[model samples]
Target: MSNDDELKQLRERVQYLEDRAAILDCVMNQARGHDRHDADLMGSVYFEDGVDEHGPVIKTGPEYGDWANAAHESVFEDHLHNITTHTCEINGDEAHAESYVMGAMRIKGGKIVSLMGGRYLDRLERRDGVWKIALRRCTVEWMMSGDSSVLASGAVKGFIKGKWDRTDPSYTRPLLLDGEPVSRW
Candidate 1:
């Protein structure tokens, strides 16, 4: 290959890697947004006209956060979303991704907890030099239940708890302990 051809290939390789990184960041941000219950953050991952589906239910991306927050609040006192084993296929301006997700939710009354495993299937588009989800579908593969009474026990009383808004420590810039309890559940 000519030198110019080799350089062109190198540049394309770099662009491909950059696109993959951006896509992964966008997928991970969804988990962060849900755990923090930050509607704006969640919505930011999607285009205004984007669509999301969870089985029989469907919603526009911009309005999904509010609905999700209300649903979670009614059932779980606290929750977390974990993303793993992601794969992406990029084709120019559009890409598809599949991400494994596990959700651990401490149910209200602290009597029960639920664990759900799922996958997020997304189709993303690069628009105006930004990548965002244009469509997403969620699949629930398995679920289990367990006792969560320990969450309210003294054993965990000293641990910093998570919050459902921007006040969550994860949002704290330059995060320092400051020698205080920080916040609680």
Candidate 2:
């Protein structure tokens, strides 16, 4: 191949990688937003007209955050959305992605924890130099429950608890340890 053609191919390869990375970031950020109950962060991953369908529940992207936070708070004291086994197919400015999700949630009474596995099927588009989900469909693959009574034990109490807000340690910047660590839920 000519030098110019080789350079063009290299640039195209780099752009493809960048696009994939951005799409993965968008997918992961959605899970983080849900875990933290951050409405703005969750909504920012979608386009203005994006839509989300989670089983029988369907809502616009911008409004889904509040609904999701409320639903989660009602049943679980804490929860996490873990993403795994993600695959994406890109074509021009549009892409389709499927991400496996494992949701671990602590029941309100701390007596039991639920483990649910699912997949997020997304149709994403690149607009104005930004990648965002235009449509998302969620599927629940399987679920199970486990005892979480140990959470009330003294050993668990000593650990720094997580918060469903921006105050969570994950959001801490510079991450310097102060005089003492306080467990704030």
Candidate 3:
């Protein structure tokens, strides 16, 4: 109706979108942090007293960081977390979200553990202009198990490049076209 009213409405809509984007960034940060074993980054996604339930075990933000990092290091030689769809319902300063996730791990016992599908349900709250997780519940829907060693049973000799930390090539290597033995992937 009035120009002033229209401008106010548009600003509110922009704020809503910005909030949604910030929340999604948190979601991705969790995935990347866990996979990279960056405990601090992972913990930053949550409030100081935030809680997370991996199955029936519930832990506070700091507790989860310690537990998850230890478990990943002891149980898996390597692991990757991939987040898919994310849907959030914003209610002013609070929101509820569910993020679909899949993960594959190279277990220490030579097993390949695959969580084919799962969901991270989150309760978020914004305080002091910052949105953070107040709670999270992870539910695994399906999984497949295999032998990790078999994947390299007949491997050729080479320096297969990868690292658990920021030293990974993804942090530095420039794009290049594929050559004879290098697939550029």
Candidate 4:
């Protein structure tokens, strides 16, 4: 191929990689925030009307946000979410992304602990020139015993110990219940 043609191809390849990386970053940030009990951060990654299915029932945007915040608060004292093996497909303004995630949590009591390994399947859309998640479904591929004390301690450590600062726009608000803010600590 001609030098100009090769350069053009290289540019296109670079653009594609950049786009993929951006989307991956968004998904990773959202997952990390959720694991770390950062509700606002998790909400920021989704569209206003996004759908989330973390449990048996699917939840709407507002419901998901509420549940996420509350659930994270009640869970562990600290958490670390590691994502890997991401596979993404882009078509026009829509895309699908999937990744494997392994998470560890430290509970409030030193004796209790919890861990979950899962796969996330996400649907994304380009909204107003930016890519945002429209739907996210988490499949818990595996989970360890849920120890209350260990979970609480881990959550406290995860949120209060500044682990949530690794990402921009952290979700630092208190968890809510029944539309009202509730204390999880």
Best by lDDT: 2
Q: Is candidate 1 or candidate 3 better by TM-score?
A: 1
Task: Give the whole-model CA lDDT for all candidates, comma-separated.
Answer: 0.91, 0.93, 0.82, 0.73
Please write out the lDDT profile of model 3 over residues 1-185, one tens digit for every residue.
99999999999999999999999998898888788777788899999999999987899976787789888898787788899889999999999999999998877765566556799999999999999999999999998877666556645335443566665544445633332233111
Look at candidate 1 and tell me the lDDT of residue 1: 100
What tens digits encode model 4's per-residue C-alpha lDDT throughout 1-185? Answer: 89999999999898778779879988887876666556676777888899888879788654675686566567655677889889999887899999898877666554556788998899998888788889989898888965465434456653323343433223434443334332344
- Which candidate, 2 or 4, would have the higher lDDT against the true structure? 2
Model 2 TM-score on a 0 to 1 scale: 0.96
Clashing pairs in 1: none
TM-score of each: 0.95, 0.96, 0.83, 0.72
Off by over 4 Å in 2: 179-185
- Cand. 3 TM to true fold: 0.83
lDDT of 2: 0.93
Off by over 4 Å in 1: 179-181
State how far residue 43 of model 4 sits from its true place (Å).
0.9
Model 1 Cα lDDT, one tens digit per residue, 101-137: 9999989888899999999999999999899999999
